[model samples]
Structures are given as C-alpha cells and as structure tokens.
Target: MSEPTMDHHRWGMVLARPRGLLTAEPFWSETADGIEEGLQHTQILFFLHQVPGLQEELEVYRRWSAQGFVHGVILVNPLVNDPRPALVDQLGLASLHAGVETPAPGSASIVSDNVESTRRVLERLHALGHTRIARVSGPSHLAHTHIRNTVSRQIAQELGISVRIVAGEYSEESGRRATAELLGLPAAGRPTAIIYDNDTMALAGLATASALGMQVPDDVSLVAWDDSASCQLASPPITAIAQDVHAFGRTIAQCVRRIESGESSFEVPEPAHHWLRRASVAEVSPPR
Candidate 1:
C-alpha cells in the first residue's frame, strides 16, 4: 500500500490551553483569522477544544497524518519538557511552533520574549506605586507561563514589591474566583493591583471588584495580558499588554508556507508586544 500523501490545501492546529469561549475569544480567533489571511489561498482549520495531554495530541497528529488530513500543523502554548517537537518530526508531520524560544533538534520555531515582556509589565506596575500585587496567571505548565513566573518572581524581588501568584485556566470563572479570594483578604494583605492572564479574565475580575464595592484603579488596578474589543468597551477600558496577535498569526502562516516550500526548519522571532494604557490603571495613593 502507498503511504498517505499531503492533504492538499489543509493544515491543522489544536488550541493548547483554550479560553472558556474558544470561538469568541478575540486573541486566538484574531490570530486564526490572521493565519487565514496570510495563507491567502490555503484553507486552515483550528481544533478549538482542549486535547488533555501530549499522547492525545500525538494521537491526533497520527490519525491526521495517516488519513492525510493536513499538510502541516501549527502548535501554540508549548509545554514544559515538551516532546511534541521530536514526536512530530518522527511522525513526518511538517510543524511550526509559536511562542517557543528554543525548539527541539531540527524543528521550526517562532520565538517571543516572554521573560523581558513580563518583567516590563511588573516594572510598569511598580512605577505606578503598586506595592502589593497579584497575578492571575494562566496554566502553570505552559512554557510561556513558566517563563513569566520566573521573571515575575525575580522582578518583584528586585523591585521590593510583594507579588502573590495564582493559577487560572484562562476562564472568566477562574478570574472571578481568584479576584474574589484576593479582595477578601485584609486590606493590608490584599493586592492593590491585579494582573490577569487574558482579557476575558480581566473583564470578569474588574466586574468582580466592582460587585464587591471596589473602584477600579482607585481601589484596585488591573492589567490584562491580551487586549480585546470587549476589554476596550468595558465600563473603563482595561489596561493591557498588547501584542499584534493577528500579525503573529500571519507570521506563523508564512513560516508554514516556507516550510512546505522546502525550507526545512528555521526560527522566526515574534512581533513586538507593548502596553495599552487605559483607565483601569492608576497611581497608588499615599497612605493617610
């Protein structure tokens, strides 16, 4: 029997750590849209649901390869001790990794400066006089998350600010829960500024703060990881670290195109990420 050949005009991706509303989530959706735009002619599809573990993801890859369902795959949210790189290579699936700084032996990657960017966020918050801060971060296992954790810790210590970190699953519920827990603490112990992992969670956290009679930026400040239309249209626009998600997606698509065109493996640097200052962040007041 002949081996399965490339599935013409088709490529696949599975959302590694999905936000609650995968379809509605602006960042990923926008990124996917960009990928489509970059692909121009090729049809691209994203597997939106969470696939649980590497074995499952690999299984998906195997089935897809065996059936010739995809020409390649775009992987995001690389895990700590990731084996997908080597595994994908072994399975003969053309792959491109987004959000990876260092890829495995002979694999393609798109790198981002999560460490420096995270440090910059903390530095900005500290500059605003936010002393006691809290971070509602995404899943702990993601490589990006790991980098942020390390950087946040180091920067917080260097700046002499107290930072409490909590894990979330990129859901509104997780944000609400984490925010409530932080706000319920004694005033002296509670964080005055909260940094959320995504816009959805940030919006929920803001509402949670308000429901508890807390005034945004006055009683507490917030900074979201990804900027969104919803974040901007909120009661007070959310302060966010904005990256051109669409451009990043398009870049991913371009890399895949290059790989398919016989460019084996190469590293593509991620686009710039910057802060979107808005009403949600305010300078801390001097104690009475």
Candidate 2:
C-alpha cells in the first residue's frame, strides 16, 4: 500500500490501554488526566480509548493510519516482547510508551522505575523483621509485573527470606481468591506479610483477610502498590508504594512534546517513589 497520505489529521495523538476494570484504576486514569492537563494549552487532540483487545488495538492503529487521522499512539500496559511498538513503527505513526523493559526501538519512553520501586517495597518490609513475604502480582505477562516478580525474588534471595508470588488479575475476585490461598497455607508455610500490585487488589486482600478472621499487621501485614483514596480509607489504612501519579502523567505529556519536536528516542526521568507507612504494617510477632 502506498504510504499514508500524511496530508490530513483528525487527532493529534491517541492512547489505548488494556480493557478491564483495571483500566478504571487510578493509575491509568490519573495518567490520562495529567496528560490532558499537560497538553491543555495546546491543540494536541488526544484520544484515550479502551479498545476490546490486542487485535482491536492493532486495528485502531491501522484504521487511524489509513485515514491519516492520528499522528501518534501511546502504548501502555506493555508486555514482555510487546508488539505494539513495532506495529506503530510499521504504520509510521509517531509513538511513546509507558514502559522500558522492551524498549520501543524508535519511540520516546517514560520508563517507570519498576525495579527500584520493587526493591524499596521489599527492603522496607524486610527491615520490619518480616522474613516470610508474599506478593499478589498482576498478570504474569505484563512487563512491569514480570519485572517486579523477578526483582522481588532476587531481593528475597539476597535477604535469605521466603517470598512467594501469586498470580492476580488486578480485580476484586482475584485479590480475594489469591489472598485466601496465601492465608490458607499451613502456618509453617504462610507468609507473614503481603504486597499487592494495585490498590484495588490490596483492598480486596484486606477484606478477604478480615473475612477469614485475620487482622491486618497483627495477623498478616499488607502493602499495596499505586496508592489511592480507597487504600487510604481502609479500616486500617494500608501501607503502599506511592508515586506522584499526576506528575507522572505530566511527565508523559512532556515526553509527547519532546517526541513531537523530533528528539531522539530517550527515557524520560521519573521521580522516585516511597513506601508510605500506615496502620497495616508491623514487625513480625515472636513465635509462640
């Protein structure tokens, strides 16, 4: 097919996130909000959509490219060996990605410091004297999820502690199920503390633990990634890894600006995140 006419455009850029209740979470929503605010003063027609699936996403790119209706596409919830980046290149659409594990060969990236974040979360738990830990992680194929699991395992080995990761789909049901499974393990094998990949799951885990008659921090400690009002408003506010998500979204906007300005592919600098101590974490109690 002949090259896209490149003569007309209906939208300045687009972003498509994976379809799920997870997409309704604070992280992606806030990021979109920030990007919009960041681009507010300009006329960069930004489009954020929750397409049906991967194939639909690719089709959006193709349709938009064919119509010369989109100038670029933002890729989020990237997976290991993600194909969207390459597809964007194939369509000659400018692009930006929200991850770095598999770099977008020709796109600007706002790489979250997942490895560092994972380390900080683990180190904080370890320092509190919790030796047996478990994490309720997101889908296994997500690049960030895999990175967190791998890094957490490495840190666990270094600390000589036991760490187990359970697969979760970033939903209430998954959280409840995974938490029950972890908490049901024999006393000798159960974790003393738990980490959740998102506040939604974390909240569910907290409820599940309580439904099972376990007290947060007292019976089982909890930590959540991607802090939110729900996490903060829980019975005993859950400890969480907090980042300036609004600022993060603005940063992605900046990357979009720079990418449009013809800047070379580069990683946008992201602010560091920290573990927010709350009522949900405690040093492991002495064994009877």
Across 226-283, the per-residue lDDT of candidate 1 in tens digits comes to 8988989988899999999999988988888888778876888888789899999999
Please report, as a residue range, the 10-residue window in candidate 2 with the lowest summed lDDT.
7-16
lDDT per residue as tens, model 2, 1-288: 767665322234333445577354788788778888888776576777666467777888888888887777777778877788778889888877776654556557876788988988888888888889999999886889999999999999999888999999888888999999999999988899999998989999999999999988898999998899988999999998998888887887887777666784887756568889999998875560
Q: Give the TM-score comparing model 1 with the true structure, all chains together.
A: 0.92
Q: Estimate every model's Cα lDDT from 0 to 1.
A: 0.84, 0.81
Q: For candidate 2, list the clashing residue pairs, or say none.
A: none
For residue 49, what is the lDDT in candidate 2? 68
Q: On a 0 to 100 scale, what is the lDDT of residue 114 in model 2?
A: 89
Steric clash count of candidate 1:
0
Best by lDDT: 1
Model 2 TM = 0.92
